[model samples]
Target: MSIPPPLQLLLACLAVFSCRHFVASHQESGDWHCDPDDEARIAAEFRPGIVTLDGRADDWSNVDGFEFPLRPALDPDEDHQYKSGKMTVKALHDGKDVYFTLQVDGDYVYSKGDDHKCPSVALMFQIGDSATYHNMGGCKESSNTCNSTNCRGYEVDIMHFSIGNSIPGRLYGGNSVNSVGLVDMYSWNPHCRNIDASAPSGNDSTALNDWKGAWWHSSFSTHPGFIEDDSPYGSSAEKGIYYFEFSRPLRTTDLLQQDAQFSIGKSSKFSAAFWYPSDGNPWHGSAHYTISCDWIPMDVISGLTSQHKAASGNAASLFAFVLSTAAFCVSIFVAYMVSKNKSIPFTPIDDRL
Candidate 1:
């Protein structure tokens, strides 16, 4: 019943012969099998907060990949008040459809009604900050902030705009004093007093209006990938996700749908940025925030694996475990061929009896 050590080693090597087949099957099947209920639960977990465990690597910072340690690490707005955390994400696919859930949480959420009166905080969950073209806010110079390829995306703003303060492109939005009934220590500026009211973005399309308690959502799609676009200044109209938040009742929610809606076999990392104020702390008032995500890939046209096996409808992780595997295989093949020269071909003796 037991195979010898030598035979076991021989069998272990047989795995190499089937690499191509495994790769093909894996590309089609995605991850293991899963029931529908499991998929729905995974989607629901990430929907309640402000985070991006579903987007490209650059969505957090100019960072090329999604490694938790590399994120901006949610520092205080300054070295003073709030704390934030790095975003973490995991995604999978099942070959038929895809779904993702994300969350961003902190000790305390900044009030939207506060509006940046004078030196008020500029809060937002903007996409494309990873690239220069998509990073531009209202006051930044240049329309498309990037010299490289431009990106088209959206953003969600949650800040304190007011009469006492002035943002680059907003008037009533930059000031939040007097509107939320704050102390009137300063002179009574004769301007709008409803900067941070619990309402939709001034009944407009801009993100600043949809202010929630402090969180918001804006889904992006079919835009340029970070792999192709990387700029420092932040671009405009390239492609990103941004949307203002509205007043929260008992609960709030949002969903993202891909425009082209295609999934890859390789495992893609997801990350996000959540910057807030940590009033009193050390390490430059470093803020500690928590973000999480779950994702499922869609199998609309292609099979779960390259061999075309049905993934039994179970969701497979987004990082389908393909790229690194292929690379390693290629390397091994090259090495073997090099070691065995064609000049040293094996010849059989002719038996002339």
Candidate 2:
């Protein structure tokens, strides 16, 4: 997994110079404390083909969502919470991949090619055993000293989507490092974030983004399609909800253990974050709003596949048919037995006496 010396040096220099991620911009506040909502658990139902991942909520009308107030990531004070509305998070899983939708009410705002001016969102999940929701995996190592060997068991997987440079309803993120704006990344701590396969050591050539996402704002009247020419697709400050859709495979071939592998019937810890340019003011990375101050639990529900469901239905029908046939045969047998026994009319008790 080690990279060549020259390439490693080049990547190291890039990391030291220009690869600081947005999550790494966390500004330390005083002691962090949180009383997470006990009922704030997301369930990814086994709903195959129910979601289209088109950044639209019409298809997710039947799916249930967990809503949370968007509070400042650094300061969870309720008084300063986002005034628009709570974020509604919905999730579903086909047998192959898992999908997520994040919807939040916000005035339409778009700044083409400028992510800081447009709205953005990110999803973080626990990958290592000891990773905490705080501190982006909460590794104790400083940026200079942090590495896979030292920060072991503190990995977290992250998927960030910035709609600035991306076309509305156009999919982004993949196996390559060059994603539009939706990138799949992992980290040991805020200072130790890296794109998949971009780690200094344990460089996994096979590692890919493993994430695809699209975005849309309810203000946009034309959701049938959108092209790059449709920059600033809708009017600014238009009242509407913003929809972000994303999907990733349930499992990946990530030998470096950077990806959070999901399994049906299992539980994982995760959190959601949103960034917005309020009042046309560009938002900084540390100034975003988060769903919770701590990790929220997510469950990948196990469900029967379509084929299995069909088979179960057939089995039920067959059982019903067999039971009915058996009942009819038993009735016939009872009738035959009664006839064979020779029906005799009982005489009155007085006559018998």
Candidate 3:
């Protein structure tokens, strides 16, 4: 009634394989665990009208900050830059609007084709309940075309900000024009942008007109229901650290746009990337940027959570421990079987004796 040695070894191998598969699946899935050290947290202490859209970080000093390291673009051919850095982000929300302050330490490089010096940053958030891969949706395909609007299955709301280049001649200390920045915020929903008439068609002439009546220009004139404010803090001469503040209503009335609306108490997933252009067109130029990884799990509460989410957080450690222990036990069993088999020597035939 006992199992054979070979069979025992086979069973152990299968167990080891299962343990390995479990660990690999979790690692490769790119699922976002609400780890306090790995994932960034955004405090929900914003009050309407309390935060002025100024680039100053004085108001944000008390709030918690999350750090996201910048890396080269996932697609080297489409977009590539070698430079690396980190962006520190802080968030707050009034009942009506949400404000974000991002600070980075890098040289200010203006967009391409522009005469004045400038720099820009962008934030992308996944909209909806479905989970999607974070590498800009380029998981299954061999090519990097997953970034294209047609291949993506989920929608992302983008908040793009630029410093010192929105206006042309408004010089700041004769180096760059103006310190206050501009925001070109929009939603990237392939399903909606392609079908909705109010959404901007995929054409060069109407590209900036993603939303009806919204204009991408140097001035502050914006379309109705479109609310965003931005400002940059840093001297054109020093070019040291730069601080940026962006504010917008939590929910917009523009139903045609692929924007995400938020309630008072809920949770969402967001991913972010930054581009530092080197040459060519700022929008299309070759730039160094970061790879979009797992989502940054955020809670829509009045304050930051004292600890990570109980249900989803700490999964990485717990799962890893279980898998490792299972794998180790299987390995030990296999080794014991092999040793036992070797310890018993073969006996000579009786006729020869």
Candidate 4:
């Protein structure tokens, strides 16, 4: 005797549905599996005054760092070219302040124009729980304009440092810009003339050519504070690798500049990107290239927070629960099918009947 076709179809449909659910769940798990290299746990080192803000590699010898491979622009155009490089980032906190050392493997292209030279680097960070996109907060509305409001309602902190004394020379600046809020910018460039112009060269070899520091809010039109603490130096032996060291008070009373808060056990999301001029001339000729990394989970360089531990436990528990539920449902269906097939009584064919 043959089983009914309807019953066979029902069992097949149940099996298909179970497999589909399992695959969908698997895909959802990938969203949370951050790249191992992108994620880092920073440990606290209480050594104040040891890590000086001098552009030298000697101070960072003991600190552990992560190497991030830099790729060309995701979308290359006529103005932007494709380039490859690597950046090594090291971080250590002295209980009151966090210090970062960034080393780039490229030539420090120095360009001289009518009145200035050009060489610079910028480090940007997302401070709080805001912004949907990691690269520049949001998309541009037009070639020359960006709708600051729609770009993601978060602020990005930028520490821009440049060398040389061009007519429009780049300077050491601390800035915070938001899509919905006013822009806060501060700089130590003599070109801005916000502060008195000093000689273009530092007393020591590690100092910049000309430096000025000032803080601004709402627009780049005013200066509020004059604080210059960041330093940069080029490598003689390695040629192009430039090292920059930055340090600041953990918390500041200054209202114009944004201060990033760090807790012992808590974590924050951090990302970085870089820009390089295409030509040696600061004013004309060469195009520029830019690249960026997706946001990574960064653990505070102190101790593991209870929240992080709880999150890990919750993820494991949720995965197990889902797996167990799927298995239980499948088992029930299998048992029902077996019982229904057994219940179909066998009828012996009798010629007299």
Candidate 5:
């Protein structure tokens, strides 16, 4: 039994990526292995197969400045195209930390785009807080959307996955450059109306570009000074394992905790909600904005893609397989009963005339 060089090559490539693919040549009729006429999933458009994400923690939370009590969500999908990994979360008195245990499929393709340097994921943390902070262009106020203004809060202070920043794929400031956080407008001063109500809305006018480029213009003369600019936060950075620590001061649990949003290429459409409780030093003096993020090696597509497969594809297929198997047995039983009734034994009757 000698394996051909081509077959050997294929196996070697598989070894480079993930050995857990379970991609046996025994799919379908199983003639796809050595029949020379076999056509199967592994044989069709399969290049060691790139992996995505599956499995998530059913529930997780953190209390004020208390240690996070979380159970890592292991890669439960053993035979999945992409295997999931473990995630650990904890909250500290001043900030939070999240750690992910990832071993990429090794077959995943490096992302391509303008931000080609880093692979990133956008993020959004709940909305409708009692107040929204607008931190942009050296200012930290409260608002949802900004107008050409590069404010501090307009951009959140977070990290994510697959971003284009220079981080050698999965490291600091690498991914999590998504634009999920909200952006809003603010005036020169703290006053809500520092902006003129009669200002035009086009970038063509030199005057307009100079004065109204607060939300976006890179070099507006009147734009606030650039110091510790937070353009990464409020954007899509939710793909990483967010190590949320600290509980809110009071138990106003009725309020929405996290209205996280995610978007691709500056368009904010992908995201979900994240909720936890209030914990941390109640008398830590000031509620300083503190957050931490680590884009551990990205092993698979997480968040949305994961939710879809788990809730739709995998669950439905397994359910159907079991149902059909049961139905087939029931049909065989009925056929046997019918044949038995027609073949009942009886004594022969002899008629004499």
Candidate 6:
């Protein structure tokens, strides 16, 4: 019961067409299937004055970190994970500002004047209620049609750091006088990204990068600071962990709503990305690894402990009780003295009249 030749050819053509359409649709919509771990949450506790923001992980010893395997941002296949190790993310807040530390194990590799050859990292945060982890905020509009007015409620705040132009342990970002590799940015989608308050047409006068960060490696020698002359600061191919420290205000003066405002005891959605030059090859813009296929939950916690609050409450109550007892005693003494000394006042008025 073999099919006829013409019918067979027709059936083959239809199968090929259906396969092509399926592939195209998958690429267009970016159909993502991810089961984010419920326990994988990053907590930014109230740890004021715990870290120095010098890109050193020693100060963050007591802070807890969540580890996630780094997978390709476009294709998250476990077999293609970063060969070195998983990345550890730690965060904390000081009531005024939020801090982050991204630690990834990798061989030291640096190339002066080329950020693509060096390790880099970026953080994307959901700034709008409709924003999503996919497609960088998941704005539907194309580049031409995407703008603040049209693509509202799809903003995601981004902070990117390329260590090639940045000195190890040196501060970058939020400096209007010069441009380091660390930059503050926002995006409606991957194709429509810009500096805060900036656009394709022109730069806004009020635009300011309100981010500060620094980078370091475990192989580097201990030093107060390193200048630009310290190129290739550490030996290449040395096994070590890279540390990227970042900080920004919990809330910014961004009337444009280009920044993510974090609140104490509240949660926010964010994702982290890492770009590494594998085998000495310069990585492209889109070739990077991410923590998860979807956004990760981050909690900004308060500083006060339950025990501390209870102690304060008990002290206040004791003070109030003592003050009330002293007042009662004084009132009773005054009444007794008045009653004993003054009884001739009421009859005098009528007698004189």
Candidate 1 lDDT, tens digit per residue, 206-247? 211222221221232334332212221133222322222112
Best by TM-score: 2
- On residues 102-192, what C-alpha lDDT tens digit does candidate 2 reach at each position? 9999999898987778888999999999999888999999878888889999999998888888888877876343366776778898878
Tell me how far candidate 4 lies from the true structure as C-alpha RMSD in angstroms. Answer: 25.8
Deviation in angstroms for 128 in model 5? 17
In candidate 1, where is summed lDDT lowest over 10 consecutive residues?
183-192
Between candidates 2 and 4, name the one with more favorable lDDT: 2
Please estimate how well model 5 matches the true structure, expressed as its whole-model Cα lDDT. 0.23
lDDT of 3 by residue, 177-246 (tens): 1212332233332122121112233212111212110112222222232222232322223344556666
lDDT of 4 by residue, 125-191 (tens): 4543463223333333422333223333343444444343221212232221110011122121111
lDDT of 3 at 150: 46
- In candidate 1, stretches whose alpha carbon ends up further than 4 angstroms from where it belongs are 1-85, 92-99, 110-141, 144-271, 280-353
What lDDT would each prediction earn against the true structure? 0.25, 0.83, 0.44, 0.40, 0.23, 0.80
> What's each prediction's TM-score?
0.24, 0.81, 0.50, 0.47, 0.20, 0.78
Predicted model with the maximum lDDT: 2
Superior candidate under TM-score, 4 versus 6: 6
How far is each candidate from the true structure, as Cα RMSD in Å? Answer: 26.5, 6.3, 24.5, 25.8, 26.0, 16.6
Ranking by TM-score: 2, 6, 3, 4, 1, 5
Which of the two candidates, 3 or 4, achieves a greater TM-score against the reference? 3
TM-score of 5: 0.20
* Root mean square deviation (Cα) for candidate 6: 16.6
TM-score quality measure for candidate 2:
0.81
Candidate 6 residues 12-49, lDDT tens each?
A: 34323312211132243356667667788999988888
